[model samples]
Target: MSIVLIDSGLGGLTVLHEALQELPHERYLFFADNGNVPYGTKPKETVRSCILSAVQELVTEETKALLIACNTATSIAIADLRRLYSIPVIGMEPAVKPAVELNRNTGKRSLVMATPLALKETKYHDLVNRLGDTEHIDSQPMPGLVTLAEELEFDGPRVQAYLQETIGDRDWQEYGTAVLGCTHFSFFRTAFAKFLPPHIELIDGNRGTVRRLQELIRGREEAPDSAAAAGPVVEFRHSGSDPAYRERMEQALDWYRRDRERAGRPRA
Candidate 1:
């Protein structure tokens, strides 16, 4: 069986990457809507439409389910998509529940790092409310990191500057646990560690996503390929106005994978 992980940009790759690590045998397909890289700031209607169209185009009947690997889309668009589509839909959520659990003893305020849209979305608000507001959660929106992550394939100093400027004194030295609310943010986990103390924890929501998907469709068997070895091959495509720019994006992503593998950054 095949599963499709859909997102508006490279951030979804983080979830895709993580899922591959956990569910090594599932045949997978990942489609990044790079034309609309950052979905956090878009209007609800626009984001919904974009995601719906991409999902329809990529999810063949042969696919087992869909994983919306984006926090902004999950918070705003998932419910609507589930109603219209018959396939199982799994989406990313902030790691507040676990972060608060770990933060109890350490007393460092729980840190939730996400895109501006993720922090402001309806689902995110509902999550906080569901937790009863008792936990001391510090929500920090790092918009520059994503914009920088896209360029880190090319510009390192710019990305570093953005992180240094954004994450000042009250960082790893302070927060007990930091949750990666955005799938794209997971890609820069290494650089993030540099900013955070060795003791601080960086957690992403991807592995949980895989476990949930496994529970949702437990006993099903399709093609032998689904139960075979995992191949972490990502096909990059761009629908931008500039052809050269699209090629550059693919090259950059390829470069990151190569460098990450060499640096011994864990890969799917």
Candidate 2:
């Protein structure tokens, strides 16, 4: 069986990266709505529509679950997805809980940096209220970070400038941790480090989200040894006419391949 991962763009691959690390035995299918990238700024209804359409197009009977890897989409439509689909529906959230926990004992402040909708949505507000100490949780809405990730500028002057422009004014010394609320933002960890102090930890939901997926799979019957030994295979689909989108997807796959080879892990 295969599991489906849906994202507004390439950002969700960060989650897919971790999923491959933790659950190498499962088949993974990824779908990106590049035609409508950056769901952060879009209207809630539009995001829901696009997500529903993607789910309808990519999910099949062989699919075991749907992982919504976009933070903005999770904040807006996760519940709707769970209700609409029969299979397990997993979603990502900013790692506010872990960030808050990391600072709770010391009474240090923690920051959650995300898109405007994620910060304003009730899903995040409830998450902060339930799992974190509200007093130490600071929310920062990053407007253009997603677009920068979409542009694929991983390092150098452009990323540095973008980080400096977005977070340069913040009192970086005060926070003990910063939760990366968007998956795209998670990809620019080095850029974030240039602006943040060494002591401030950066956290994201990728690993935790993948682990939860593992836990959900534990309840089901195991795949045959032949299937498990075959390892993970990622099938990609993009709902856009842009050739650049396909090229970007290929680049991401190649990066993963090279990293795995460097680590001496067996290829799928």
The residue-by-residue lDDT of candidate 2 on 178-254, one tens digit each, is 88889877666766766788888888888888878888777774555776678777788899898678779768655
What is the alpha-carbon lDDT for the whole of candidate 2?
A: 0.82
**TM-scores for every predicted model:** 0.85, 0.91
lDDT tens digits, residues 1-268, model 1? 6788888777776666556666666777777777887887778778888888888788777778889988888988899878978878999898888877777776777788898888988788788888764457888898776776665443356656767787765746567778888877876777776767777777778778878888876776554552364454444544445556556545555655665676564321
Which residue runs of candidate 2 sit more than 4 Å off their true CA positions?
Answer: 221-228, 253-268
Clashing pairs for predicted structure model 1, backbone only: 11-184
**Candidate 1 segments exceeding 4 Å error:** 133-135, 171-173, 225-238, 241-268
- Could you give the C-alpha RMSD of every candidate to the true structure, in order shown? 3.2, 3.5
Candidate 1, which ten residues in sequence have the lowest lDDT sum? 226-235
Residue 165, candidate 1: alpha-carbon lDDT: 82
- For each candidate, the alpha-carbon lDDT, in order, equals 0.73, 0.82
